[model samples]
Target: MTTLPDHYEIVRERNGYGSADGAVGPVPAAERRRFVAVDDEGVFDRADRRRTLVATGVGMTGPPHLGTVGQFLTAVALQEAGLDVQFVLADLEPYHGGAPLDRVRRLAERYRTFALDLGFDPDRGRLRTQEGAREVMHTAQLLAPYYDPDRWTEDAGDDSGDTDPPPTEWERAVREAYEAGEDDRRSGTAAVARPGPSSEAADIHSAVLHGADFLHPLYAGDYERLVLQFGVDEHHLVGMARRFRDAAAVEGGVAGLYTRMIPGFDGTPKMAKSIPGAGVSLATSADEIRERIAGDPGGDPARSPVFQAMCLASRYDAERLGRLERACEAGDETWDRARSEYAEFVVGLAERWRATEE
Candidate 1:
């Protein structure tokens, strides 16, 4: 019989001691919220250990953005707070359709270097590409059958004898739009703006038209397989994470795996890379960051893009940054002043952090 790690004890105390049933009466909102709050007043108690942190995300395309920086800060905070941290770079999410395979390879190399530049270890708490973790993919495949077809569809195609045509009007419209785009010279307004027949669009169509076919099945299956492979149920996994935290407490406690979903500059929703003007990238440089910050119209300083970047960057204490954010939102200050202040502050913070680490 395999015994749980000594570290597993720590994981249980912080995350495992909870009810599986999604109920709230026994657990107050304040208690539940503590699981995520990381500020000094909330739960960054410098003495509790039982947190284990892991971050997983797709990184096979596009440049690393401020969102990636936010995740890095999250991991850094955990490490600073004394938790064991693991950062997983998910690169297996298909980056190419058919051609340009070499481009994908180059992008991967660039991103790996970028990760290193950002201070993540390439070995210890370093990167783990999706390709490097095939078990995760396999697990996803095994769990496909458990998902409801109405809620999920697979890409089994005609092999499964499910040859039904696009069922919804939206899907039909998408198909028509795709077919109409074959001729580049099509001139109508609809033709001009129609979604192109790119593989990206095709993948979207497959998901919308088929549902749960490509990834959902894998997720549902692999989750169970992972539980067994690790010799722990869903509840146990939670326990392990918490136990890891508890064990780390003796050396200044540990930071839990909590992430804040910062909203976009427009205050509409969470900043998304795909949404036009939804976010700024980490590699956006000081000039771009300043420009975006100076241009935002949100009244609450807390909602200013500059402030958002600072928060995401974790460069300043929340209280001070909150004040700056508010000042920007109130229109009491000019963009130039705010931009100058933010840029200096960010540069100083980065220097201090690097020096301390060294």
Candidate 2:
């Protein structure tokens, strides 16, 4: 584990991260809203004050990318704000997604390394793999009885990646097979709607299991507050905190931290390694970072991934962040210097990670 600062206090690019922007103070007109919008900010704020456990729950299906670190950055904020952090590695999930078992296993094994390189504090909270979590599996079984197939699939949503095709009833197929495989299956009590024809039955099943895994800690009566950091698209997962409120009553409060996914270098909807030139090369240098920044069509910082990356790299460097954000909004030349400095930070990160491997 690397040494972490007492607090990652940075001049936020936006006012409230996931709360009311003006609730605390005044700022830029555009700074009012957060990159990730939450419908129930009031309740979430109440939970935020309690001892919190910040967690990232996602399958290890892809290589490390710029957007992946964004969640870590959010974790750093929550941790610095005094929340414990947990990295939920859904290692068993790729089995359902049709990804290679060996590849996913390797990714899962190296996830801790990735988190450390990204500056996660291990002593505060450690990474837990889903496949090995018996309690989580038990909790998933308990949760399964609560979710009929229709409701489960409806909430499951496709969660399709950029390269993935349309939804096509993927949830239905997976749930049915999962229920069938269950030795204690109940008929006519599962899903009402039939899923679209797709062979990927395990994907939805794994998601259900994975979601249950994350919710388990909250209901287990340990942590006082649990904050989950997922992408904007996965904000619906936040609703789980609501559902678990009754169960959480004896346990703790739960909050959701959702961040905007940075766009690709060419400004795709979200950055991914599969996005041709839009991908973040693990071997990128300071020069490559400059090119990406220079080509950026800076309009709203919310939509600009380059600018967002600078914000994440800055971490606790609030003054530098404020200057960058102010310069960016006004299209000032200071943004150039900001970009150069940010580029160094990005390059330094990759070098640190690379050196760790050596």
Candidate 2, residue 88: CA error in Å?
1.3
- Runs in model 1 deviating more than 4 A are 1-53, 96-99, 122-126, 135-258, 265-270, 282-287, 333-338, 343-358
- List CA RMSD, all candidates: 14.1, 11.6
lDDT of each: 0.40, 0.54
Give the per-residue lDDT of model 1 (tens digit) for 1-358. 1112212232234333322122211222322221222111222222332322233333444555555666665444434544344454534343323325465566666655555665665443436554455554554344434433342333222112244323233223323434444343354423122222247554443222121222222233321111000111112222232232232221222222223334455433434444345566544556665665566654654345555566655445646655666666666656457667766655543443333333
What TM-score, computed on C-alpha atoms, does each candidate reach?
0.50, 0.68
Candidate 1 TM-score to native: 0.50
